[model samples]
Target: MTMSSGNGISFYMPRYDFTVRARWLERNARLIGVLKAAVPTQAIFSHVVVSGQTVGAVTRIRYDGPGVMVPRVFGSVFFYQPSQKINLCYGEITESATVNQFAEVIQEDLDALRDLGSKVWADTVANPVRHVVQVNIQEW
Candidate 1:
């Protein structure tokens, strides 16, 4: 089945192990928000960007839409705003879950997200790891 919720598209998989559930957030970034990399590798992860909206304590990013509770998220996760840089060391890193209607990220988490963004930017084309590179936000 397919459905649209919280700035993203949701494809629900009937079974957990028997199927795959996928949620794709368009460039909106608000749905999935930029998050700390959870690839089972990559040490020192952190980030959180809150778009133009300023959320004081906690901000709701993604909710019960599509892969909200599926696949499980672990380690330091980030929820960053689109078109913004990540800051991995912006704030204290932690975990949170969705409740009632949507998943919420605290301010500290947002700060951390910013730190990760900076790190990613620095480690990537911004610093030229292997070859000279340039980062264009609008183009990306």
Candidate 2:
């Protein structure tokens, strides 16, 4: 968004390309316009680049289709990224029952899913360590 000052010129514009915590402005784009009308300022929200999603699951399923015997559909859990307020997050998968939400992510899978934030649950086998690291060290 570009704003023009009284002299029939545009104000300096800046492009923001990054993730920002949920903000009130996100729900009110109209406020930006109001500010433009009342004052000489412009604000722009770069296209939303959905970096990634944290959910209960990501799944691929097959279903009957018109031309094909089975069609493939990709689904994921939709939820907010790990932030200070949300200690435990749940994924509202794109559609219910499409993804496998029952499967548990064992502790060993932590490194691979580092950005998965942190899992806050009772330290039970369902989320216990399983995988082992293979290493051979030789001292000379």
Candidate 3:
């Protein structure tokens, strides 16, 4: 299943999952909006995947965009499992059953998802890591 926002951000997940948690996604539209604005550009594609009991919300640059080479970026608060603590990019958030409440919890985390998105973009483009190499000759 897929849901597209007016600003060119599209979300995808399994049809069964969507049927089960459609309301959750609907209630957290603001969170999706936050993700849409987290990146520098307006073209983003997000896919939600279910692994075991955890759900991950992954974002990537659109293929038609300038950042087509940019790797996928995940929301800071990606994993969501009822009755289990949701892990953040840097830490963990308290457990909750409803997705709406989860959004509230994330909001209390000072917009961690947005921060993570920006940081990933900066690290990938603005300030990429540089590797230095040194070689030494040895006699055996």
TM-score of 2: 0.17
Model 1 bad stretches (over 4 Å)? 1-102, 130-140
Whole-model lDDT per candidate:
0.26, 0.21, 0.28
Tell me the tens digit of each residue's lDDT in model 1 across 31-92. 34332111111122212333211111122222322323222132122233332221112333
Could you report the Cα RMSD, in angstroms, for every candidate shown? Answer: 14.4, 20.2, 18.6
Which model is ahead, 1 or 2, in terms of TM-score?
Answer: 1
Worst 10 residues of 1 by lDDT: 11-20
lDDT per residue, candidate 3, 1-140, as tens digits? 23364322222212211111111233344444444444332212122222212233332322221111111122333223233222223223233332322122223333433443234334333455722211111111
Clashes of 3: 0
Candidate closest to the true structure, highest TM-score: 1
Off by over 4 Å in 2: 1-60, 63-100, 115-140
Which tens-of-lDDT digit does each residue in 1-140 have in candidate 2? 33232211121212111111111122222322332243332222111112222312111212221211111122211111222111112222132222211112233433333323222111111256532211111111
Q: Give the C-alpha lDDT of model 2.
A: 0.21
Ten residues in sequence with the least summed lDDT for candidate 3: 131-140
